[model samples]
Target: MQFVILCKDKPDGLDLRMATRQVHLDYLKDVGGANLLGAGPFLDDQDRPTGSMLIVEFPSEAEARSFAQNDPYAKAGLFVDVEIRRWRWGVKPPAA
Candidate 1:
């Protein structure tokens, strides 16, 4: 199944997010691999990242939660909230 992981950064967390970004990317690449459908940061009006959104495939919600909890940004305490939910791609899904 596909899951969406929405992460909200803590207030004043830009510095920590930047510092941990590379490691976080690496972790996503390492673990998410083909299951990582898409991922990116959520930007504010000033075009600064304030959070993240990731869509990934996992057999169960438990595995998806585990993936979210193990993210470098999560480990570094950059997020104030993280929400994971089942997702449906209603438009322009990749060609099979």
Candidate 2:
């Protein structure tokens, strides 16, 4: 199933996020792999990242939760909140 991993950064987490960015990218590339459908950050009014959203596929919600928990950004305590939900691609689905 596909899941959406939504995360809100801590109020002062930009430095931490920037510091861990490359490792976070590596983790996503290494672990998420083909299961990663789409991912990016949520921008604030100043065009700075305030949170993240990732759409990923996994066998179960439990597995998806585990993946979210293991993200480098998560491990680094960059996020103040995280939410995981089953998702449906209702429009403009990716080409096969």
Candidate 3:
């Protein structure tokens, strides 16, 4: 199944997020296929990352939750809140 993980970072998280970005990227690389689409920082007028959004594929919600719980960003206390929702894919057909 596919899941969408929405994470909002705590205020003043930019520094920490930047500091840990490489490790977080490495972790994502290790779990690459699980992630279908991902992006970070909700962005503001200045176009800076304020939060994160991810869409991933997993066997179950438990698996999705586990991935979120073990994320380097999450472990580093980057997210003030994280929400996971099962996704229904294919609203729009892939471009041919």
* Each prediction's TM-score versus the true structure: 0.97, 0.98, 0.87
Which residue pairs of candidate 2 clash? Answer: none
Worst 10 residues of 3 by lDDT: 32-41
- Tell me the RMSD of model 1 versus the true structure: 0.7
lDDT of candidate 2 over 8-95, digit per residue (tens): 9999899999999999999999999999998999999998999999999999999999999999999999999999999999999999
What are the per-residue Cα lDDT tens digits for candidate 3 across 27-90? 8778755455555558978988888887787889998899888889999999999999998767
Candidate order by TM-score, highest to lowest?
A: 2, 1, 3
Q: State in Å the error of residue 3, model 1.
A: 0.6
Candidate closest to the true structure, highest lDDT: 1
**Whole-model lDDT per candidate:** 0.96, 0.95, 0.83
On the 0 to 100 scale, the lDDT of residue 9 in model 1 is: 99
**Strongest candidate by TM-score:** 2
Off by over 4 Å in 2: none
Those runs of model 1 whose alpha carbons end farther than 4 Å from true positions after fitting are none
After TM-score superposition, the amount by which residue 4's alpha carbon in candidate 1 deviates from its true location, in angstroms, is 0.5
- Cα TM-score of candidate 1: 0.97
